[model samples]
Target: MVSAPTNLPSALAAALAERGHEVVVHTRRVDPDAPERQRLPSGVVVQQIVAGPVRPIVEQELAPWLGEFGRALAAAWRDDRPDVVHAFSWASGLAASAARQQLRESTLIRNGAAAAPLPVVLTFTAFGAEQHRRQGPVDPGLANRIRLEVALARSVAAVIAGSDDEVEELARMGVPRERVTLVPPGVDVSRFTPYGPSAERTDAPRLVAVGDLTPSSGFDTVIAALRGLPGVELVIAGTTSGDASEELERLRAGAEQLELADRVTFAHSAVRDPAARSALLRSADAVVCVPWHGPVGAGPVLEAMACGIPVVATAVGAVSDVVVDGVTGVQAPPRRPDQLATVIRGLLGDPVRCLGFGAAGADRARSRYEWARIAVDAERAYRALVPAALPAVDDELIHSNE
Candidate 1:
């Protein structure tokens, strides 16, 4: 699997290994001292391949490295070919496409974001409005990147969508309907199950939100919703540094303005261990995911459901897919603070109802979103792409067979 330098692919690689599959994660760069290979209990292998340096400034550094990285992938594939190659981003898809031309036996799997080519101009106007509201100027590079991603997606054997909303987005971008597959992100249900009885919270309903505390995530909206709610405590676990620090401070000030300073707490500390993060999810009465911009998917929604916690989320991107209207959790319109507060208030008021939603969410997750099931589906897709034997035809053979 090829992905950018991030934690998403790392978790996926580990989960695939746990499902008894050999997983090799390829990123743009790697630490030389890192172990070359690690064997899991299921006998799966993980090989990390760092193609090159990934610099943020696209023109000065990333452009040249992209070409070099593509060539390096071709060279590596020529030495030893794998049965299937899964590419996570557009650049990875381009590399896998090049390698497939060299080694005719391998199947290419592609996954990433998709955007419409000519989104009625109003889309850009709306994006500009949102950008001006948060940041100063809109980045033109965002639109260009979306177009390139759409082009690269068309060249793969199968495209794995992280959400149903993303599938619709890809369809709008001219990808053939037959090639797209809806494979939403999966979670390790066992690891994130309900915590011990002693760890449960018995006070007022605890609402937990986790993500990079940025404007795009609409964390400010969540803060706004919690402002006047009595006896409700909000715990936000995520980073408040870099570009997001200013926004985080703004949110804190807002909470203070509403006289909710004591009720809200920001856990700037990282839950470095997965067990800790899982425990946090299990301890919460409900998980709140509110994003202003519609993302393809959010990991917290799945994690919360895995822990048997009802979710309250904005109806953006694939969030609706994970949080059924009243089954798993409640869905409110994006950026609507009042609606968000109302939903949370309703859920908190009815403990038995919220518990039922949490139970249904856990059942859904176990039945449909397990990593083991996803691995089997992925393996089946790979086999379908690779043929058992090559077809042979000659003048004499054709005549005799006929």
Candidate 2:
């Protein structure tokens, strides 16, 4: 079940369905007139469960609507129960748990036999602890979110963590180590490749940074680093024009203050289109990802690598795992502009090293980060629970490249 607005859930659903699994996605109603059940072009079933208003609400505001959402899920699964209930976030996990409990109770009351419970698999995009550490105690909802995440982690059959850092964090929060699996998010290798057309660039070298235009995103560090590298231009591709207008202004103001306004370009519309985003990556001489926290995942870094562009990312989250320092790309500490600049200067100065890193990065991305490969890993996780819930037949049907 996808409880948030992130793209990962739908992408994963599509990938899983492509592997011949019967995937049904449950999400809250965003349009009042839309049908309750719909099918995507990829043939995945999507059920828009009624909970609250059709209007969009923040993730924190979703707490009050969960009961209704869970009931709706239970109703949908009453006639046909799925072997595994995979939830994409903490909110989804809570709703899935409630629905499973309701199903179990109904089965027990009807037949007087204990039905084998539906196993729920969970994946948390970002843990509350990481948020608390980054945003600090000023956030009022942080405590409650952390507590609920801990409880949900313990309740789920399996937890897929995007990074080794996340696995350690879950262990510190009291979740068993055995229950957590390390599965980094995948990238679309076919779309993001070196063969694609790149975004327009000047004769000067370019460094592209992609993420939300927030203070913690560390775009400022890139801007600061640009001051030292005189000839190179930087393109920070995020913060679409209308959305986050304030942040857009803030970043522009920072660039102006540093007297490097002409050198930096903000590609506002690049993120909304896959082709444009891939083009932007291909245009980059090197991609710089220096977010202050681990929640950024390895998305931009991996996409950049997939495009055969060298990366200079902070050693946080799965990015640290994906980028091999001095091999595929360079890794640096977060919030360090001087150190980041030094590496960028070195990388941009040597064309042979840049080509080497880019080639290696593309190889790693194709070999390890493909969507099909990730779907297989997820299928294995689902198969682990299926034997206890359903009859097992043949194992030869499944194959693995990892």
Candidate 3:
């Protein structure tokens, strides 16, 4: 498995390893002092590779390093040729496909573009639009990033999309339907399920929002909604990287302006570290995740449902597919603070109704979004791409100089 060492990729790698697969993780960063080899319970072997930083390298330096990295990956593949190679994001997919070509192996690519338009462009455009609306026109690095994504997408053999929306987007960008597969992200229901009675909380109907403090995530919108309602505390969890500092500050200011500084508490920590995050979610009355523009994956929503917490999220992207409004949870219009506030308040006022939604959410999560089912689907796809065994061919030397 080749992917960036991000949250989703790490989780997927662990899940794949747990399924009795010999997983070799190719990452962009690996500390030299760290353990050289760590064995998983199912005997998976993880191999880490530091591909160097993309930010500091100039175009001239970048091209050469990428070529060298490609050569190294090719050499590794030739040494231990696997049945199939799975690449996780567009960039990694491009690199993995190039390496696979050298080793003559089949490749499977998974889309980790959480939001539509790629990460850099999405962030720049979102921040630019917000800044432009408030001040004036600004130069957003959107066009360049879109061009890069289009180029990268064209090079992959098969693109595994996280949702139908992503498939449609990839299709519009010239990727054929046959090349695209809709595979929604799955949650480990066994780890996230609400097994016992709901935990007790002292606060007046706590509502939680978990994700990075970025503009696209719209945690600010949740804060805005919280301002409209009294006796409701909104807990915002998740750490922000350098790019999101400005947005985080802006949200803090907004909370202060709305007199919700005391009501809204910001927890600059990860919402994925099982123990801490599970405890936080279990104590919540409801969970709210409203992203402005997203084919939102199964992170916050799934975790909340697993903890038997009703969710109120924006009806954008895959959220509607996850939360079956009124049954599992509630859905509000994207960017509409009033609607979000109303839904949150309703859930808080009626504990019994909220409990019913939570129970339904838990049931849906366990039934449909289990990681075992997802892993089987992925393994099936990998098997379909590779034949049962190889046939010996004539010893003919062929060379291409194109």
Candidate 4:
């Protein structure tokens, strides 16, 4: 269960569907007027459990909708039971836990026993400490969010931690080591292949960054970094066109102030399509991902690596784990434009090193962060709780039938 369509849950669901699992995503209906069920391109089924009008998940007012949402979930899952219900946020976990309890109670009283309590798994995308550290003071809902996350970790069959740091947090939360699984969020490597640096881009090297135009994202640092490399152009992707958001203006102002108007290009619309985003990443000579310290595997970095493009990312969260310094990609300190500029310049200067980083990154991404492997890992965790979840093929029966 998730509040809305987030990159992590949506990607995992699609990957799981591709792995032959019947993936049904349960989430809130952001569009009150639109259909509740959406069939996405990757063949995952989505069912929205609408509590009320659309609201952001992080807002404090969302707390009142929990009970209603849980009932909706219970109703949705009654006939079509899921082998494992994986909740993607603290609020979603609360709803899932309550719904699961309700289902169990009803099953026990109505039938002889409950159909072995559905192995509920969880993924808290951000650690509270990391959140506080990155943004300074925490939100009003943060303390409760952290508490709920800990409770979910203790209750769930397994926790899908994107980084090893999360596993440590789970241990501190008193969640058993056996129940925590280090399954980093993955990227689809098929479409994101390195088309070997663009043949058309002969004028100057280009660096691309994917995400929204926000202050905390550290795009200003990229703009600052681009000042030194006059030849290198920085492409900022994810903001929509014709909207005067202050964040966007601030970035524009920063570029102007830094005298980088010609060097920085803002692709004002988010390339939501994977193929398009992959194409954008593939077109670039290198990708820069220097967001403030946050959750692991925020999508762009892994996608860039998968596309066989070298990345210069800050050493935080999963970026630290995935990028092997000089091997796969370069790492810089968060909020440091000088280091980022130096690394970017170094990569742009040496085509061989950039290609090597791309090649190595592609190899690492394919071997360790493939969706098939991640799905199998998730399935294994589910199997630990529900041993009969996946049945083995009967080779003898097939042979006899043949």
Candidate 5:
């Protein structure tokens, strides 16, 4: 697996490793003094490739060094080649593609015939064209990034989409639908559960919104929804203490302007600590996620569902697929605070309905969105690309363990 160091990729690598696959994660060497290779407790190997300056940098800025990173990967894998290379994000896909090409060229020179390019499966967390369409080319590197992303998608063996909306987006970008697979992101079911201790809250109904407090995050819509539901308090969990980003400031000012300063609490600690995040989700009457663009904000929504909390989300991306409307949760059009408020009010007013949604949500989350199931889905995609590469599963052993 190739990706920048992040929670989702790390969890996925660990899950794959636990499922008896030899997982090796390759990432750029961000810290000057960090080891080039380290083994995680989950038995996954982390190999940091030297690309540019050994310091932290954003993905957009890191693009220039991807070629060098690819060369390093090619050298490292010359002898110990992985059967399947799964890349997360556009940057990783570019590097994986380059490395595969490099290996193929090397084989052609060394042998009589050209060796087959290593099979690579890519998962784009968000598409560049989608973002450019929604937010414009705000980042200077965005245009070039979009071009590279489209080419990379075309070159990859397969593309794993996190949502149905993303699959459609990929098709519009000229990627064949047969090469795309829909595998929604997963949650840690054991950590997030209905039985866990909930965070302290007032008797008034509560709504929790989790994610970065950017303009596109739709947190302002959440605050607006509070205006309609008088006694309801809104908890926004994302920022850390002492970090004064402009977006966080804007959200605070907006909340104050709407006279919801007391009603809206920015829980800085909840996003950093897993225990606190789970507790906050458990305390929520419903978790709200209404990002204007981007892949379904899977982290917050899936985690909330796993905790058996009813979700009140925008009918965007794979959210509808995850949260069954009027069953597991309620869905409203994006940016419509009135509709969001109405849905929240309806869900909160009927405790029986809320309980039913929570129960159904918990069942859905456990059955479909757990990490174990997600790993299986991923493995299937990998095997489809290169069936002989992965080890065959032993059904008798699985049954014995169960």
Candidate 6:
């Protein structure tokens, strides 16, 4: 992992580590004064790189960071190497690819013959181009990002998608179908389990909405839905704290303008921690995730389900792939407050059905979206790319010869 802040790589590294696989996270934080190395609770080694100034995630900063990361990775791999290099994003993929190339070249120089390219597995959580295409006119680095993804796809042995929606995007970007694997991003199911008794609010149906405060997040739509469902309060648990973000202010203004100030309470603090977030999810009657463009990791949705809370989400992006409409929970079309209100009302009206949905969602989350299962799938994808590691190939060759 090259970028340190994102939770996907950290969650994945921790998950893989728990599965008895060694995970080394290489990253650089914007705060140069931060610690150099730290060990995560799950036993993964996180080594921070000493790159340049604090910078935003743009092409200018990304290219230089990739170079810095590649050099460091190659140096480390040269001493005590790893079997496979798995990168979290396009920038990290480029760095990992460069390191692999350097290692291969060094091996060739030492020996008479060239060895096979070191297996590299890349996970692009979101394509910049794809996101731009969805929301109308293309973004600034649209061409550059697409070209980079296409180039990396050709070089990497395997590409693991965060969501099934990304699989088609990967294919469109020139990645072979065989090279792509759809592994939905996972949540810490063990911690987020719904083993405890329900914390239902007797006064009113409390609906929880967890995610960023951006306009696309659809908190406004959820608020609109709440107008029809009287006596229900919506708790928005993820807007940034301290000086409120523009989005947060906008949301507060919207709530006041809609005369929903009494019915809605913004948590103000972003619930990034799994335990806290899980607790927040558990405290709700139902969790609502109605993103206009769809969620990036489907984190909030999966976390809510894992906490045994029925979700009322818009059927968009990777959400449609994970949620079975009316089975696990309810699905409302984007920007439809009337339809969304009806769905939420139905779930709230039937306590038995809400309990059933919660139970079903929890079971599904445990079986399919658990971190352990996700880690194993990712591990297998990496192992499949490594020729020396795939001893089954040798066994097959021997059998064929016989």
lDDT, candidate 1, 1-402, per-residue tens: 654444325555555565545555555554566565555454444454555552222221344466566566656655654445677656556555655564443322222333111000001101212234356654666555555666666756677676766667667767787777666667787787755431345587788887666668877788888864678888887643234577768889988998887878776564455776787777788888878675535566887887889998877766777788888888888788888888889888899988998999888888878777765665555445554542321110000000
- Whichever of 5 and 6 has more lDDT, that candidate is 5
Per-model TM-score versus the true fold: 0.80, 0.94, 0.81, 0.87, 0.93, 0.89
List of clashing residue pairs for candidate 6:
none
lDDT by residue (1-402, candidate 2, tens digit) is: 555543337666778778776677778776788687777887677778778888666666889988888888888788757777878778878888899899999999999998887788888867888888876674667788888999999988888888888888889888898888888788999899999798888899999997666777799999999877989899988643235878888989999999999999988676888899999889889999888776766877888899999999887778888999999988877888898899899989999999999999999999998988988888887778776435443221221100
lDDT of 4 by residue, 1-402 (tens): 444444236666666676666677777765677567877898777776777667435434567888888888888777776666777766677788888898999898899776777667777755665566667777868777767677778887777787877777778888899888887777777767776443234567888876445566678888898867778888887533224388878888888987888788776553666666777788888988887745645467878888888988887667777788999888888787888888788888899999899999999888988888887777666556655534542110000000
Candidate 3 — which residues are off by over 4 angstroms?
Answer: 53-64, 104-145, 196-201, 239-243, 270-272, 390-402
Q: Write the per-residue lDDT of candidate 6 for residues 1-402, one digit (tens) a residue.
A: 444344337677777776666667776555567577777787777776654555435433567567776777777667856666777777778888888888888888999778777667787756776666677876566767778878998778888887767887887888899999878878787788886544444577799986566677788898888788889999998643234477777888888998988989876453755566677788899999888774345777888888889998876677777777888998888888888898899889999999999999999888998888987787677666666645442121100000
Model 1 scores a TM of 0.80
The 10-residue segment with the lowest total lDDT in model 1: 393-402
Candidate achieving the largest TM-score: 2
Error of 1 at 395 (Å): 35
- Candidate 2 stretches greater than 4 Å from native: 138-140, 239-243, 388-402
CA lDDT for candidate 3: 0.62
Model 1: how far residue 164 lies from native, Å: 1.2
At residue 291, candidate 1 shows an lDDT of 81
Worst 10 contiguous positions by lDDT, candidate 3: 117-126
Worst 10 residues of 5 by lDDT: 393-402
Estimate, for each residue in 227-270, the C-alpha lDDT of model 3 and write its tens digit: 66888887887554335668768888999998889888776554
Task: Flag clash pairs in model 5.
Answer: none
State the local distance difference test value for candidate 4.
Answer: 0.72
